[model samples]
Target: MALNIKQTAVAGTMESSDVMVTVKPAEGQGLVIHLQSNVLTTFGDQIRATVQEVFSDFGIRDAEVFLVDKGAIDCVIRARVQAAICRASGEGFNWKGEDK
Candidate 1:
């Protein structure tokens, strides 16, 4: 289920309690996450873990992710990351399947 990312994509917004996620193809670069969040000191690990989980779920092994968080919860982060990844990969999600 490895995704062949064709272009960069973004999802979500910068509103309060929302997060903006950008996914880009990085052919040989493995997964690289650049995150900026106000709660970095308190929830950085959790946020990164969420993003990593999404990447793993999509079987994405090479890509660069940029995330700007505005206090978004776990679900929001997961959705945004998933959306961005789908857009970048030009793939449709299987909402009722194992992707969740």
Candidate 2:
């Protein structure tokens, strides 16, 4: 069920308690994740794991994912990832902001 990314797309904002997620088409490479966050020392592993799980759930095996975290929680990470994927794939999706 892996879907190819059509183009670069971004979701969310670099605001407090939120995350900005970007997805782009990658050739040959599969799911490269780059994450930056203030809480990386304490939460890096968890955040990375969560993002990877979200990608797996959406069947996204080939893409370059870049995310900037501003103290976002797991659910926010999931929502932003989903929204970015939808936008990159040209699917209609609206992220209702924080509460996701």
Candidate 3:
């Protein structure tokens, strides 16, 4: 079972996500991603797919992401994750990809 995720409201055209995941103390640390979004405009699948793709680029596994959206595009989500990952790892958002 998983914990219920809540929304974190903010003003902007951003598609943000709150990710929480754990690494095993031992071996075989698998990946886990929990995504929740209020971006109810037939764009949930696209957003989810984009997030997964971005995560792969950063070599991040075993992370849960909860997203609450309000009319946001896939680009926004990708941007948010890029920013969050940069902040998380104390690096930069080296995002080099075509606009979705």
Candidate 4:
């Protein structure tokens, strides 16, 4: 089932090796992402693809995502996105399902 976002939520930090992500409900926006990263010239597409993959995993189709990157790796980015999504949707992540 798709996650139904109920409110805006944020995760992560602006630390040198971290990334901050904000998630908000957008009924018809269809996964809008606003990203700010100093490394955009080189890693923009990869970063966006990582975020998109997380959204797809959670079955999210509509939402507004604001991300501020600080040279974080793909795993960190995925974790932050998932955390924000879970908080916004007021749901706990299904850890068991992911192990399969």
Best TM-score goes to which candidate? 4
What total of clashing residue pairs does each candidate reach?
0, 0, 1, 0
Find the 10 residues in a row with the least total lDDT in model 4. 91-100
Candidate 1 to truth, TM: 0.95
From the highest lDDT down, the ranking of the candidates is 4, 1, 2, 3
Candidate with more favorable, higher TM-score: 1 or 2: 1
lDDT of each residue in 1-100, candidate 3, tens digit only: 1211122222233334432222121113433445455654576678668867876777666455555565556666666665555554545444454443
After TM-score superposition, the amount by which residue 45's alpha carbon in candidate 1 deviates from its true location, in angstroms, is 0.7
Q: Which candidate ranks first by lDDT, i.e. highest?
A: 4
Off by over 4 Å in 3: 1-29, 95-100
Per-residue lDDT tens digits of candidate 4, residues 1-100? 6889889999999999899999999998899999999788899899999999999999999999999999999899999999999999999988897779
Question: For model 2, how does the per-residue alpha-carbon lDDT over 18-46 read when each residue is reduced to its tens digit?
Answer: 99999999978988999999999999999
Compute the lDDT of residue 54 as modeled in candidate 4.
Answer: 93
Write the residue-wise lDDT of candidate 1 on 8-56 in tens digits: 9999999999999999999989999999999999999999999999899
Query: TM-score for each prediction?
Result: 0.95, 0.88, 0.57, 0.96
- RMSD in Å for all candidates: 1.4, 3.7, 8.7, 0.8
lDDT of model number 4: 0.94
User: TM-score of the candidate numbered 4?
Assistant: 0.96
Candidate with more favorable, higher TM-score: 1 or 4: 4
Question: On TM-score, who's better, 2 or 3?
Answer: 2
